[model samples]
Target chain A: MNNSKQGMTLIVKTVTRVTVWLIVLYGIYLILHGHLTPGGGFGGGVILALAFLNIMLAYGREATQKWLNLKFLEDIEAVSATLFLFMGLLGIALGGRFLINFLPKGSPHALLSAGNIPILNILIGVKVAMSLFLVVWVLAGLHEEKGGQS
Target chain B: MILPYYIAIPLLSAFLISLIAGKKDEWAVLLSTTAGASMLILSIYSLIAQNGETFVYKMGFWSLPIGIVLVQDGLTCLMLVLVSLISFTSLIYSVQYIRHMDRNWKYYALFMLLITGMNGVIITGDLFNLFVFMEIALFSAFALVAYGGHAEEYEAAFKYAVMGALSSALVLIGIAILYSATSTLTLAKIAEKVPTLDPGLIFWTGGLFLAGLGLKAAIMPFHAWLPDAHSSAPAPISSMLSGVLIKVLGIYTIIRLYFNVFNAPDFYMQVFLVLGAVSIILGGLLSIVQWDMKRLLAYSSISQVGYILVGLGIGTRLGILGAVFHLFSHAIFKSLLFYNAGAVEMALGTRDMRKMGSLARVLPITSATSLVGTLAISGIPPFNGFISKLIIIIALIKAGAPVYAILAVIGSILTLGAMMKMQRYGFRGETEIKKISEKIGWRMNTAMILLAVLCLLTGLMLLPGIRESIVDPVVKVLVDHSQYMQLVLGR
Candidate 1:
C-alpha cells in the first residue's frame, strides 16, 4: 500500500518482473517466424511495445528512464525508420525494384529462410517499440509536471 | 522503376532530417528543400519521358493484380507535378516563415512525409495503397494543423482528426465492400470487374466513397473544418492544405475512383453536379461575410473547388479539359494568395482585414503579387482563372446544362465581389495602424512573386501546342475510363 516509491504495489511489480521478459521473447519469436506465421512486423512490434509498457506501468517512470532514456528511444525510432527506408532503397540499388526481396530465399519455414522479411520485421519492431515507449514517456512526464505544479 | 523514387526520396529525406535535425534548423530546411526540388525535377522528367504513354512499375517483381504497382499515367503525372510544385514553393516559403517557430525540424519532416504520401497516392495502382497513403497525408496534416499548439489550433485539429478518422473509416468500409464483391485490391482489376457486379452493391460502395471523400474535400455540408484548420495553421502549411491536400486527397481520389474504377455512372455524375453547385453557392456567400484574410481564402478555395467539380460533373471532353486546367491554375493562384496573406500577417501581426490598410505602399511585392492572385481567382481576363472558367462555362452550355452554366457565372460574380472586398479593405484603404512593421522577408516575397508569374502564364497552357502536350493527355485519361485499365494492365 506504500505509494512513496515511484511505482505500483509490490505484487504488480513482482508479476511484471516475471512476465515482461517472456512477452518480449515471444514477440521476437513472432517476428522471426513472420514469414511462416500469421504475425508479421506490425503485430509482433505491438507486442514488443506492450512488454515495455508493462515494465513502465509496474516499475514507474524513474525505473524506466534508467533502463531506456527518452532521447535514446527517439533516436532509435528515427534510425530504425531510416534503416527500413534504406533497405528498401538498397533493393533498387541492387538492380531490382524498391522493397524487392533481393536476398536468397533459403527454405520456407526456417527462421532465416524468408529473404528480407525478418530484417524488415526487426527494423519495424525496434521502431514501433521505441515509438510507443516515447509516447508513454512523454505522457508520464506531462502528468508528473502537472502534478508537481498543482 | 523510376516511379518508386518519387516516394522513396521524400520518405528517406523525412527520416534522415529527423535523425540529423536535432535542433539544427538549417539541416531540416536544406534537406526538405532539396527533397522537394528533386521531386519536382523527377516529375518533370517523368512527364517528358512518358510523353502520353503509361508506365507501370511493379514492386517486388510481382506481376500485375498480385503485387503493388506504381502507374504513371497522364493524370498521375499532372497530379505529381502539382504536388511537387506546391510543396516546393511552400518549403521555400517556410524557410523564412517558420524560422520564428519552435520545432522547425518536425515541420520539415512532416512536410516531406506529406509530399511522400501525396506522391504515393498519385502513382499507386492499388486501392488499399491509396488508402494507406491517404492516412499518411492525413496524419501529417492533422499534426501540422496543430503545430502552433494554441487553444484554437488544438480545437481545430481535434475536430479535423475526428472528421478525418470518420471519413477514413467510411473509405475503408467502401474498400472492404469493393474487395468483398470483386475479390481484388488492384485498381485496374477492380475497374475491369466492377461493371459486371450487382448494380445495388456498386451503388452502395459508390455512395460510401462519395460521402467519405466528400468530407475530406469539404464539399458544402462537409466543410466544417476547413475555415479553422486553414486559418489557424502556420502560413506555409495553410498554403499546402488549401493548394494541394484537398485536391489530391479528396478530389483526385474521387475522380480516380468514380471515373476509372466505377466507370462514371450517370447517377454519380448528377451527385457531383448537385454537390458542386451547392458548395460553390454556399462557399462564396460565406466568404463575403468574413473579415479574416485566411478565412476568406479558405471559403474561396471551397468555391473554386466547386467549379472544378462542376466541370468534371458535366461529363464532356471539354468539361474534363476545363476541370483539369482549372485544377492546375487553382493550385498556382490559391497558394499565391495564401502566401500573400501570410506575408500580410507577418508584417502587420494581424489577420483581420479591418486592421490592415495601405499595405500596397509598404509591402509592395506582396501586395502586387496578391493583386495578381486576386484577379486570377476572380476570373478577370488575361489571368489563368478567366480562361479555365470560360472553358468550363462553354463546356457546360455545350453539354446542354445552361442552368449550371448560369449558376457558375453567378458563383464567379460573387467570387469577384469577395476578392474585390479583400483587396480594397486589406491593401487599398488608408493606413490604419502606422506603427506596424511594413517589411516582409525576401524568401516570402520570392515565393509569392514566383507563384504570381505562374498564375499569369498558366493560361498559356490552354493554347493548342501546350494543350496537346500537357492537358490533352489528362483529358484523354479521364474521358476514356477503359484506358486506365488497359494502361495499367498493359492489355
Candidate 2:
C-alpha cells in the first residue's frame, strides 16, 4: 500500500492519455497508408496494441472490460483472420492464385496503390492488432494469477 | 494441388471450432480428432502423389518471385504427416486428459490454432510467411503452456515467451536481410537468386537464420527456454510441443531454408556438426540429473534433436535420410512417451519420479507403451530409433566425422541411462494402490497404443519400396538442392 504514494499527477495522466491516443491514431494512419509508405499491417498493429496496453494499464482490467472486453477482442481476432483467409481464397477461386494481387492497382506510391495490398494490410492490421492485445491480456492475466494452483 | 488443403483444413477448422466450440465443448475433442485424422490421411496421400513433384498453390497467380505460395514437396508432406499423426493422437488423449480442466473451448481453439500454424509452416513456400506461421504457432503455444495459470506454468510461459520473441525478432531481421539481399521472399525465388546475390549478405543472413531458428529448435547453445516450457504445459500439450512443435518450428524450417532457399555451405554443415555433438552430449547428461518425468523428456528432446542435426549435418545422402527418418521416429516415440507420462500423472496425481512406482502393476498399458517408447528412443534393436540412429552413426563414420560418430554413440548410451532411470523410479518402484474410482479410459489407451504402433512400424520406412515411396523423394529434395528451385518455380 505504501507503494501507492508515488502515483501519477492529473496533468501527467492527461498528457499520457493524449499521447497514447495519438499513438493509436498514428498507428491507424500508418496502417491506412501501408501500401503507400514503408509501414504496414504489422507495424501499425503492434502500435495499436501498445495503445491498448496503455489504456489497460491506466485503467484496471475491470474498468477496461466495459469497453474492450475479452470476448470482443477474441471476436475481432477471429473475424479478421477469417476475412484475411476469405480474401486469399477469393483470389484462388478467381484463378489468380492464393493471396494474389488481384484487385486493381491504384496509382503507385498512393494510399490506394498496390491493388489488394492495402486491403490485405488492413485485414492483417486487424488480425495483428487483436492478436497482440489478446496476447498481452493473457500475459497480464497470468501475472495476476501468480499465486494460483497449476 | 494438395498444398492448399494442408493450410486450408486447419485454418477452416480453427474458425469453425472457435465458432461452435463453446456450446459443443464435450464434442470438441471428437471434432478436433476427426480433423487431425483426415489431415493425416491427406498428408499421406499428398506424399504419395507428389513424390518427385513439387506442387505450388500460388496465392493469387501473382506469379513467382512475388506472391505467396503453399508448396508441397516430399519433405513437407512427410513433416505434415508426422504433425497430423501426432495431433490426431493428442486430440484423442486430450478428451479424457482435459476432463477436469476449465475453459475447454479456449483449449480446443488454441489447439486448432497451433495445428494451423504448424500446417502453415510446413506448406508455406515463402520465408517471411514461414516466420508468420511460426509466430502463430508460438503465440498459441505460449498461451497453451500457461493455460493452467499456476505459478510454475506462468513462470515457464513467461520465460518461453521472452525467448520465443527474441528468436522471432532475429528471424524477422533474417528475413529482412534475405529480402534485402535477394529482392525476393519466396523460397524458390530466393534459391534462384542466391548465387546472384553478394556473398557477404548471404553470410550474414545465413547466420541470422541459423541463430534464430536454432534457438527455436532448441539446439544446444540456444536451448534455454525449452525445458521449462515443455515441462510446464499440460500433458497432451507437452506431448505435442516436444513431439512435433520443436521439429516443425525449428528443425523442419531450418532444413527447408538451408537446403531449398539458400545453398548449404561447408561451414554451415561444420557448425551444425559441432553444435549437434554438444547438444547430444549435453542434453543426455542433463536429462540424467532431472527428477521430473516431463522435464527429463524435455531434455531428451534436445538430445534427440541433436541426433537429427548430426544426421543432417553429415550431408551425405545416408545422413540426410537418417535425419529425416529420425525426425519421423522421434515424433512418434516422444509423443507416445509424453502420453505415457500424462497417463501416469493422471492416475497418480503427480509427475515426480521420486513419489511412487511399480506403477506398472497398476498401469499396464501405460507401462507397456512407455517401455516401447523408452526402448525406441534408446536405440534398442528392432525399433524405429535404432534404424535412424544406426544410419546417422554410419553416415557420420562415412563422412569422416568419427569424433561425432563416437559422440553420437555416447549420446545413445546416455539416453538409455536416462530411460532406465525413468523406468526404475516410475514403473519398477512399489507404491500403495488406492481403490481406483474411474477406469483408465479407452481414449487414453488408444492414443498411446496407436503411437506405439507407429513407433514400431516406422522402422519399416527403411524398406526399399517404402523408402522409395516415402523417404527417397524427401531425401532427393534435400540432396538435389538446385533442382528444388526449378521444380517449384517451374523455370
Error of 1 at A36 (Å): 2.8
Q: Taking the candidates in order, what DockQ does each have?
A: 0.59, 0.37
lDDT of 2: 0.85
Q: Give the TM-score of candidate 2.
A: 0.87
Give the alpha carbon lDDT tens digit for every residue of B333-401 in model 2.
Answer: 999999988888878778899985786667889989999999999999899999999999999999988
Clash pairs for candidate 1: none
For model 2, the superposed segments whose C-alpha errors exceed 4 Å read A1-73, A90-96, A99-150, B196-200, B432-439
Chain A of model 2 scored by TM-score: 0.85
Q: DockQ score of candidate 2?
A: 0.37
For chain B alone, what TM-score does every candidate structure achieve against the true structure?
A: 0.98, 0.97
Residue by residue across A28-115, what tens digits does model 2's lDDT show? 9989998777798999999998888876676556556666668877777888887888887777777546665677886777776788
lDDT of 1 at B32: 91
